[model samples]
Target chain A: MALGLALALLALVLALVLAVAWRGTGLALGPADWAAVRFSLVQAGLSALVSTVLAIPVARALARRRFPGRGALITLMGAPFLLPAVVAVLGLLAIFGRSGLLNRGLEALGLPTVSIYGLHGVVLAHVFLNLPLAVRMILQGWLAIPSERLRLAGSLGFGPSEVFRHLEAPMLREVLPGALVVIMVVCLTSFAVVLTLGGGPAATTIELAIYQAVRFDFDLGRAAGLAGVQLAIGGVAALAAWGLYRPTGFGAGLDRRLEVAAPAGWRLWGDGLVLGAVTLFLTLPLLAVLLRGLPGLAELPAQVLPAALRSVLVALVSTVIATALALTLALESARRPRGLIEAAVTLPLATSGLVLGTGLFLLVQPLATPMVLALPVTVLVNTALSLPYLYRVLLPETRALQADYGRLAESLSLSGWSRLRWLVLPRLARPLGFGAGLAAALSMGDLGVIALFAGEGQATLPLVVGQLAGAYRMEAAAAAALLLVTLSFALFWAFDAGGRRAAA
Target chain B: MLQLDHLTHAQGDFRLTADWSANPGDRIAVIGPSGAGKSTLLAVIAGFLAPTGGAVRWKGHDLGPVAPGQRPVTILFQDQNLFPHLTVAQNLGLGLRPDLRLSPAEQARVEEALARVGLAGLGQRKPAQLSGGQAGRAALARALLRARPVLLLDEPFAALGPALRAEMLALVREVADQTGALVLMVTHDPEDARALGGETVFVGDGRANPPVETGTLLANPPQALQDYLGRK
Candidate 1:
C-alpha cells in the first residue's frame, strides 16, 4: 500500500510535468520569461552564498562556546523554519522599510537611508529565512569533529589559525558545498518570499511570473511555460542537492556538549561579537514583529479572522495527509530500503508548490471553476510540498523500529493495525509527532499555492498578510502576520508536545 | 514430525542444505562456525526465508503457505525480545492477542506467565527498567504464554552472564517440556550444546548434517567440526 501510494505520488507529479510540457509546447519563450529565469538563478545564488558565508563565524562561535542559553539559542534557530514567510517579510520591513526604524535612525544621523526593495530586499528575506538553517548545518559539521581530534590539536599546541587550517577548514570544505547547494535549491523555487518582496520585470522569479501570468494576464500557455521552466530548474537543483546532501547529524549534539579549544583574549571578544550580532540579526526582526503587531492585534481587519481559520483548516487537513503519506512511505521503505521509494518520497522537493498548483489549475480549469477548488488544491499542494521533510524525519525512526523489533512483532502474529498500534506507533511516536508538527506548521505558514488558487473569499492567512502588505497596510499586515505565526506555532507545539508526552 | 525435506537455501554467495526430520518434542542444538548458515536454517523452518529447492512440513502437511506469525513457531532473537516502550505485562499480553485487547482471563494468564518466569511483580515495569536477567525472563514469560509447537532460539540469552544464561536455558527447557514443543537452539558454544543436553546438528561447510547424539558427536567429531571447535 505504501509503495502504491509512493508510485501514485510519482505518477501524479510526472503527469503534471507532462501536462505542463504538453500545454507549453507551442508557446515561444519571451524576454520576460528568460529574465525571470535569470533573476531566479542570481537571487538564489546570492542568497545561498550570503547565508552560508555569514553562517561560518556564527556556527564556529556556537560550536566552541558553552554558555547559558546557548542551547536555547540553538533551539531558537529552528524557530524561523516555522515562522511564516509573510510574517518574516513584515518583520524585515518594520526594521528596514522607508519610514521604519533603520531609516529613521539613519535620517536622525543625517545619513543616506537604505531602501529595502528590489534584488537586495529579496535576498535579505531569503537570508533571514535560511541563515538559521545554514548555521545549524555548519554547526553540525563543527560538532561532528571528534573531541579526541580537538584534544589532539590542543596537545599539539595548535593555535586558532592552525586549528582553522587543519581541523575547521577541512570540515568546512566537506560540508559547505552541500549546505550551499541545499540552500540554493530551497531559494530557487521560492514563491512566497518572491511574491511579496520581489516583483516587477527585473526582479521577477519564474514562480512569481507564473503567478502573474495566471492571475493578472490570464495567460495559461505562458503560465505553463513558466511552470515548465520552474520544474526543470527546481528538479535539477533538488536532485543536485539530494546528491550532495549528508545528514549533518543536526540534533545529536544539543546535549553532548563539546569542549574545543577556546582561545582567550581578542578571540573571546570576537566570538562574543559574532554571537551577539547574529542573535540581534535573528531576534531583532522577530522583536519588531511582536512590537509592531501587538497594538494592531485588537483591531485586525475583518478578513483576517476568517483567513486565519481557513489557514488552520488547510494546515490540519494537509498535516493529516502528509503525515499519513510519510508514515506509509517511511514504513514501506524502511522494511524494504528501496531507492525508488526514496525517489518517490523526495519527488515533492523537485516539484514546487506553484508548479503543482499551476498544473492542478490547468487540470481543474476545464472541469470547473478553479476558484472553487482553491482550498482543496491548497491542501493537496501543501501535502505534496511537506511530504519529503516529514518522510525524512520519519524514515530513520521507522528503520530503527523495524530493525529492532520487526521480527519479534512478526513472530507474535502482529500485523496490520495490530502491529501499528502495539509496536510501530509507540516506538515511533516521537518522530511521528515531530514530523507532523513540522508538516502542520509548514502548511499553516505556506503562502505559495494558496496565492495561485485563492480568490477573495478563500484566502488563507498568509495570503491575507501578503495582500495587506501589498496594499501597504503595514499595521494590519503585521497584526495578521502575528496571528498567522501564532497559529502556526500553536499547531506545532500541540503536535510536538503531544508526541513527546505519548512517547514518555 | 517437523521435516526439512531436502531443504536448500542460498543468500548471496552463501548456501546451505538440510534434508532431515525431527520428531515431536525433540530438543535439538544447532552449532556451527560463524557465517555457516546456522540462523538461516532456523529462518527457513520458521518461514522467514523460503527454501530455494525444498519444503518444510509439519505433521504430514506442507507448511509452505504459512505466514511467519501463523506458523506454530516462536523465535527468540539475541536481544530485543521485548518492546522497550511497553510494560512487561503489555509485552507479554501481546502473545495472547496481537492487538492487546486482553480479556480479564487473558490478563490473568499474562500475570501467571510472569510469575512462572520469576518476574511476578515486575509486570508494570517497562522493558528499559528491567535488568538483563529480568528482561530475558520477561521474554521467556511471553514465549510461555504463546505456547507454540516450535520454538527457535537464535542465541536469545547469549548476552546473559554464565549463571543467568544457564538459568534461562533451564527455564526454556522447562517451558518446552510443559508445552510439549520442539526446540531448535542456535549456539556457538559446545558447552551450551551440552547444557541444552539434546541431539546436536553440526551445521558447517554449507551443509547441516543429520542429528547426532550430543555425547557421541563431541566424543568423535568430524575433522571440520574438530577444526571449528579447536579454532574458536
Candidate 2:
C-alpha cells in the first residue's frame, strides 16, 4: 500500500505538471522540438545498433576462449557499468580533447590533428561506455547456448561456419533485439556525456535542451513543456521497445566453468591483436587521467579532500537508502507479484537524472528552504535515481530466493519480520551488498543532483571537477577526476568485500 | 490436533480439495502423483495459501485468521532448508528467535540442538559448506528448535540417497516422538511411508482421502494408490 501510494504520488505530480504546462505555456509541438526529438532517436538508435553489432564477435571470442588474465579481462568488462558518466567523460577528454594526449602526440609526429567535438565525440563516449556492457550481455547470451548442442555439432563434423549458421546465428537473433532495446533506452536519456562532449548545435540532445531550458533560460513554462515532450517520447520509445523485446535466456546454471579454446597459431595472434587494440582504445583515456593527475596530487589536498569527504557522506547515505528501498521493493514484489511496481522502479532508467533533478527541484523548492534542504534533497534524488540499478541487481536474486525458499519458510510460519530475518535477508546478503556497492559508487560520482543544488561550498567531487574544468583549472580538474575515480572504485571494492564477507 | 474441512485450492491449472483431520500424535503421509497437489494441500494447511472454500482448525480454533509463521507449526522444505549466508548455529538460533539475540544458556541450547543433529562443531559452517544430508539434518534440527506442536515436511529428504533418507526419517520420527507433535509429510515413495510407518493419505483426482494404516495401504492398496505407486 505504501509502495502504491509513493508511485501514485509521483504519477499525480507528473500529470498535474503536464496539465498545467500544457495550458499555460501554449507550447505547441514545434520544428525545433521535432529536430531535437529526431536527433535523440537517431543517436540512440545508431549507438545501440553499432555497440551490439561490434560486440558480437568480441563476446563470442570471450565466451569460447580462455587465456592468461581471463579473470581480469572479464572483470574489466564490468568496469564501465560501474564507472560514472562524468568521470568517464573527463577521462575521454584527457585523451581526445584539443590539448589532450593523442592530439599532442599527433602534433609531435607532425600529423594532422583530429577533432574531438560534436557527433564524433558523443558517439565515442557512448561506445566507450556501452561497448563493454554490450559485450557482457552478449557474452552471457553466448555462454547460455547448451554445450551439448555444440558437442553434437562437433561430433557430426560440422565446420565452424556451419555451426555458427545453425546455432550461434539463431541465438544472436533471439538475444539481439532485447539487448538493442536495453541499450537504446540507456542512450535515450544520455545527459552528462552529451553535456561534456556535444560541442554545439550539431550535437545537442533533447535532454541537454531540457537542461538548458531550465537552467540557462529559467523558462519554467518552457522547461515544463519540454519535460512533457520528453516523457511522451520516452513513453513511446519504451512502448516500441517493449513490442520488440523478448526474454533472452533464463541465465540459471550457465556454464561458468566453460572455457573457450584458443585457435591455431596465426589465428590466435590475430584474435589477440583485435582484443589488445580494443582494450587499448577503451583504457587509454583512463590512463591519461591517471598520468595527468599524478603531477597535480600535491595540489589536491586543498579542495579535493573536502569534496571527497562530502562525496563519501552522500554516497554512504544514498547507497543505504537505495539498498533499503530496493530490498523492500524486491521483497514486496516477491510476495505480491506486482508488475506495475516493477515497471515503476525501472521508469527512472528511461528518465535522465537531469529531468528527475529538475522535477524534484521544482516540486520541493516551493515547500522548503533550498539552502538547508540541499544536501538531503541531493541524497534523495541520488537514491531515487539509483533505485533502478539497485532493483535490477537485487530482483533476480530475490525472485530466485522466493522460488527456492518461500514455501519452506511459509510452512515453517516464517513471514513478515521473521521471514525477512531468517530467509530473505540471509539469502540476499550477497546481491544486496553488491547492489549497495553499485549504488554507492554511482552516487559518489553523480554530478546531476549536485549540479542543480550545490553552491560554492557544497560541491561533490564530480561537481568540483566540473567547476574546475569551467574555470580552466585543467590540472586541478584532472587531479580531482583521478581522486573521484579512485574513490568510486574504492567504495565499490570495499562494499563488495563486505558483501563477500557477509556471504562467507 | 489439526483439521481440514473441505479445503480446496486452485493454483493456475492445479486444484486440490482435502478433507481430513489428525489427532495430537497422528502422523500422516500424503502420497500422490507428480501434479496431484500434495504440497498444495500442506501449503493450504500451513496458511501459505487461502483456500477457495475450506476451514483449517487447530486445537478446536480456526486457523483462517492466523498468519503462517504465527501458527504452532514448522516445516522443512525439500531444498534451501537453511539460510545460505548464516552459519549452521546461526540458522538454528534463528528458529529459536527471529531477532537471534540469545543468552548464554539459550546459546547453549542451540549448541545442544546442533550436537543432537551431529553438527555441534560444524555450527560455524554455512549451508554451502554442508553436504546434502547434513543440510537436511540442519533443517530438521532448526524445526525441532521451533518447539511447534505440528511438523510439516515437503518431500524434505527426496533428494537424499536411500541410506541418508532413512537416517533423516528416523531422526524426524525421533523428534516427533520426543515433542509429541502431529507430523504431516508429503512423499511419493512407498519406501518413505514404509520406513516411517505413518498413516498414509492417498491424494489424487483433485481430492485427498483420510488416513489409513500405512502397512495395509501398501500391501492391499486401493486402485488410486495402486496406480499412483505403480507409476512410481
Candidate 3:
C-alpha cells in the first residue's frame, strides 16, 4: 500500500506539472527563456568542469599524504556538502562580496575591486560547495586501489608517472565521469546559489526565472514553460548521472590511510601546497561568516526567531514523512524486487523544487490562496525531494536484513505492526537515524519552494537570509545564516548521535 | 500428520517434487547433496515458499493459505538463528508473543525455557555476547517456547564444533520429545543422519524419494547414494 502511495504521489505530481506546462501558452520558449536555459547549462557545465579538475590534486594529496590534521581535513570535507546553500552563499559573500575581505585586500594592493556577481560568482560558489563532494568521490577511487596492485607497482620500480598511468589514471577515468555528471545535475537544479549571486538577463537560471515569473510578474504560464525546460535539463542530467554513478564504496575504508607512493622533495611540497590552498579556500569564507555573524547574534531581528521556529517545524515534519515513506518503499521493494517502487523513489531526482512548487501553485490557486499553504507546500516538496536519498540509504540495509532475518521473523509469526516494531525497527535503526538526519538537514536548509509560495510573514530562515542580504544588511544576513547553519547541523548531529548510541 | 502431497516447487530451471506424509511425532532426516533442493524442500514445508504444483497439508487441512508464521511449524536455519540485536530472553519472548508484551506468567516461562536450555541467568545478554554453542542453545530455547507441532532443522548447528553439534542435536531431540513435534532435520553428513535416528528421505535427481529406514538405507545404499558417500 505504501509502495502504491509512493508511485501514485510521484505520478500525480509529474502529471500535474506536465499538464499545467502543456496547457499553458502551448509550451512556448521565449528568447529570454532560451537565454535562461543557456545560462543554466553553461554555468553548470563550467562548475562541474572546474570543481572536478581542481579536486584531482587535492584528492590525490589527501589519499597519499599523512599530516597532523589529515584525518580532520578529510572529515571537514564532508561539512560543506551538508552546509546550507544560503549559508554557504553568505560565507562566500563575506569573503568575496564587493566590500568583503578580498576587495579590501585588493584596495590595499591598489588592484581594482572585483564584482562577485554573474557567471563567475555562481561558478565560484558552486565550486566551493561541490569541491568537497568531488574530492571525496575521487578519493574513494584512489583508496579503492587494491593493496596488492600498489605493492606490484612498488616492486616494479614504478615512477610517479608510471603509477598514474597504471593505477591512478584508470581509477580517475572510471570515477571522474560520475563525479562530473552528479555535480552537473546538482548545479543544474540549484536555486539558492544562483538566486543569491546570479541575476540579470545574462545570468538568470531556469529556476530563478521560474521564481521571478511567479513572484514578480505573476506569469504562471511563463513559470510553467520555464519549469518544462528545467525538467528536460534535469531529466537528461539525472539519467546520465544514474548511468555513470558508481557507489565507490565510499562509506567504508575512508579512514584507512593507504601508504601510497608519496615521493619526497618537489612532490612533497607540491602536495602540501595543494592541501593548504584547498583548505584555506574552503575554510576562509566560513571563518569570515563566523567573524561577521558573532556581533549580530546578540541583537538578532525579532522576526528571525519565528522564522527559525517555522523552519524547524518544516524540517521535523518533512523528515518524518520522508523517512516513513522511504521505509515503506524500501521494505516493500526488498520483499518483492519491483521496478515500479524503485522508479517512483528515483523519479523525484529529475524534478526540481521550483517545478513542483509551480505545478502545485497552479493546482492550489483555484481552491485557496497559495500563500496560506506555504509551509505545508514546502513540507510536501521537501519530503518528495529528500525521499530518494533516504530510500537509497535504507534499501541495501533493508535487503540485507530481509535476506538474513525475513524467514526467521516470518516463521515466528511476526507480521504487520509487531514485525515492524520488534524486528524491522531495531534492525534498521542505524540507517534509519542517519537517513532521517540527512532528510531533516536538507529540509531545514531548503530555500526553494518557500521562495515561490511564501508571503511576507511566512518566510523561512533561508528566505530571511536572502532578504537581509538583498537589502544590504550583511551583518543581519550573516547572523541569520549563522543561526540556520547551527540549527541544521545540530539537528543532524543529534539524530546521528542518537543512532550511534542505539546501535552501540 | 504432516503431508507434502504431490509437492513440486520450481524456481527458474531448478525443481523438486515430493509426495509423502509423516505421522505425528515421527522423526525424518532429509539428506541430500548441495543444490539438491534440501533447503527448498524445508522452505516449502515451513510455508516460506509455495509449491508450484501442489499443496502442503497439516492433519488433512491444506496449508496453502496459511502465512509462514501462522503455520504449525518452526524452522531453524544453519546460521542467524537469533537476531543479534535482541537479548536472549527477548528473542525467546518473541516466540510467545510477537509484540513481546509478556504477562508475568509468560515472562516466567521465558526464563524457564532459558534455564532448560542451559542458558540460565544469561537471558539479558544479546546474541553477540553469547558463544557459538550458547547462541545455538538460545535459538533452541526459543523453539521450546514456541512448542509448535512441527519442527524443521536446516543444519542449524553446522557452525558448532563436533562435540557441540552432537550436544545440540541431543537438545533438539529433547525439545522435540517434550513438544511432541514431528521432526524433519536436513543434514549432509551420514553420521548426522545416523545420530538423528529417523527415516531417511533422499532428495536428488529432481525428486525427493519418500522415507526409507536410515539404518537400512545406509546399509544397502542405492547407487546414487553410494556415489555421493563414495565421493566424500
On lDDT, the leading prediction is 3
- Report the C-alpha lDDT of model 3 over B87-173, residue by residue, as the tens digit: 899999999999999999999999999999999999999999999999989988998999999999999888778899899889999
lDDT of 2 at B127: 86
| DockQ, all candidates in order | 0.84, 0.51, 0.82
Superior by TM-score: candidate 2 or candidate 3: 3
Query: For model 2, how does the per-residue alpha-carbon lDDT over A196-231 read when each residue is reduced to its tens digit?
Result: 777366777878777776667766565666666667
User: Please, what are the lDDT tens digits per residue for candidate 1 over residues A342-444?
Assistant: 8887788988888888888888999999999999999988998898889889888888888888888888889999988978888888888889999999999
Question: What value does the lDDT take at residue A212 in candidate 3?
Answer: 98
Q: A411, model 2: CA deviation in Å?
A: 4.0
Q: Candidate 1 lDDT (Cα, whole model)?
A: 0.89
Q: Would you give me the overall lDDT of model 2?
A: 0.77
- Tell me the TM-score of candidate 3's A chain: 0.98
Fnat computed for model 3 = 0.82
Worst 10 residues of 2 chain A by lDDT: A246-255
Return the TM-score for candidate 2, rounded to 2 decimals. Answer: 0.89
Give me the runs in candidate 2 sitting further than 4 Å from their true place.
A1-25, A28-35, A238-269, A301-303, A365-373, A412-419, B108-147, B161-170, B191-195, B229-232
